[model samples]
Target: MTRKRQGQQGWGPEHPEQHYLVQPRTVAGGGDVRHVSEYLRASGWRDRSKRGGPLLVESPDRTLRVAYDPHGQPGGWTIHGKATGSTQEWSAHLGRQTPVEIVAGITDTLPLPRSAHAPNVWGPLADGGWHARFEGNSYSATSPDGTAWLQYRQEANGTALWWTGATDTRGNSWTGAFTPTTPLHVVQAFSAQLASPEPVMRPRGRVPHSSKIRTWSVSVTPSQLGAWQQARINAARAATWARNSRRTDRPSTSAPPYANAGSVRTRR
Candidate 1:
């Protein structure tokens, strides 16, 4: 019996079935599948491929799948399994951002988790302050000049709690994590710093008595103050109108006789 000699039977220029088999095309920026697969698995992705078809890895929950195809068009890899069927492609040489990082970045852009205890006033408060609650976190800010604001947030990670704060005046910010306790004193210190008035700087040397004293003052006539007050009132009215309109569009839920009234009276 004569044994048929084995020969190259796959695609590519040297293969006998080059015309019938799909040509291996270069994925722009995708250098090598081996390298991509190595990096992905090194970054905590689990390889689920049993027979080595395409490079397939999934998140812990299997909600996300990152697949690498050497012959895939546009790019080499596809990020799919999102509810919207939204997909992102990546090539080896093009994107320095990893697939996992990209998914995390997208997740961060989503709206904060809504809470039933969320503040009714979504915008700035009447006393030049603002506060909101979302996903068990509290956010607060005080804007004395509208443009310059002091903001703070208390965030938690499992059993750990921390505080982050920022001031719009000088764009100063701070984050304190891994504290043994709640670190309420740090928040108090930040609040005090925000409340402190800007220091008045003067020349060390005494000026000549002949020089006139320069002073600054903000003057608002009664009419101007009244107009400002009216503008705030109008804004509040508009916000209330929009909120009521949204509620009207939704199905009404059964409530006790004083449920709505009680909610209105409660302070967040």
Candidate 2:
């Protein structure tokens, strides 16, 4: 169990190797926004982040605005993308607890071309044995253990949403949502991770676990954890090396729009 340092000297890549801790269901504590801030800087997003201010950046086109100011704003992230150049292009405000990996899933894919207009959002959750229910224009899904849920509504209902959330056995929950303008593929990326039965690793001291409930927990030998860590390190190095080889140095554009009011609340 070790602490993950912030900033991108070498501290990035989508998945950092998991440790002994489990990401608690009730509170959003384990993920780091730096995982994303660093990627944005590397992928060519202009690092306009001022010292002692919220981490900030913009796309080359200047349409997308991503800001990470965890303390100044407990919301954690504000992603704005105006591909359509409309007031409603797309925007998402992610809370402090939203897992950085899932956020990466959506943001990282933004620069890629979207040829497949329609993506299957439910398939991944279904594969994971999550149940789906649809009534009229509203659609939703929930995890088998009843610790997570996702919903998408077609009609504009004040604030647009693609809520993806998970709860721990104790009933605590953390949530992240994207707007309607956001790509389904992007939303799917978030959904797919939530649908995953894979355990989320954290530092052992920080995990929120009751004496007997550990459905999301897994035991790993030190040797196994070590090997897995080294492999991930190697992969990250290879990726960085390849990027350096092919490109000059510049990061790029990312995830998107809409804003009003939202929150992450634990279930009592």
Predicted model with the maximum lDDT? 2
> lDDT at 183 for candidate 2?
64
Which tens-of-lDDT digit does each residue in 118-146 have in candidate 2?
78888888998888999577789887767
Worst 10 residues of 2 by lDDT: 255-264
Predict model 2's lDDT versus the native.
0.59
- Deviation of model 1 at 167, angstroms: 45
- Candidate 2 deviant stretches above 4 angstroms: 1-18, 21-28, 72-74, 85-88, 115-117, 154-160, 168-172, 210-268
lDDT of each: 0.30, 0.59
* Pairs clashing within candidate 1: none
Estimate, for each residue in 119-205, the C-alpha lDDT of model 1 and write its tens digit: 322232333243334444544444343322333335466443333222222212222222323123222322332333321111112
